[model samples]
Target: MFRLILEEEGYEVHLSKIAFEEVHEVEKLDPDLIILDIKIGRHNEGLLLLQQLRMYRPTMKIPVLICTAAISVIREQEEILQHKGIPVLYKPFDVDELLHIVQQNLLPSETKDC
Candidate 1:
């Protein structure tokens, strides 16, 4: 659903089934921005991947939008909260808001008119 809507907005989208897959995709695709869920699968989650990305030199600086329903859970994590640059989007999100955040992260600062 997100991929379709994003594609309709003229952005290329890649869907990954798990957090590890997303890390691999990021390594291969070097995407402009990443929309990550707080809880990806039963075992692996976004916080772990986010930590790995932050440690990796190549992917460290990439913008991440943390979109998830587990807002309360995330707030309890002091480590995740420490990263001020990462933006959080609670679940049941509006498409327009998602688009806006995507554009804001992916576009050049001067080029952003939205």
Candidate 2:
């Protein structure tokens, strides 16, 4: 669903079912932004992956947007995520909200002429 939504908006989306083991591949892709889900196969695999990605210089500066249904886990790491400038969208979020965040992350240099 998320991929379809983004694609419809003219953005290319990639799905990685085994993202935990493909961090290097992800760096190679050099995506403009990453929308990560905290519960990737395991309860907190996404968080662990996020930590690993941050440690590497290649992926440290890429924008990461976290989308998850795990409120408890989010609360625990909210401070850390905030410090790293990462944003989180809780599950069941409105599609408009998701698009808005994605645009904000991707089009930081574009300005609307008024």
lDDT of 1 by residue, 1-114 (tens): 777778787776777768874455577767778788878888437888988887788888777788888867777864655456677777898988988878778756422111
Each candidate's lDDT (Cα)? 0.73, 0.81
Cα lDDT tens digits, model 2, 31-83, are 78888999887567898889888888898877889998999999999998888
Over all chains combined, what TM-score does candidate 2 have?
A: 0.89
Best by TM-score: 2
User: In candidate 2, residue 89 scores what lDDT?
Assistant: 98
lDDT score for residue 27 of model 1: 71
Residue pairs in collision within model 2: none
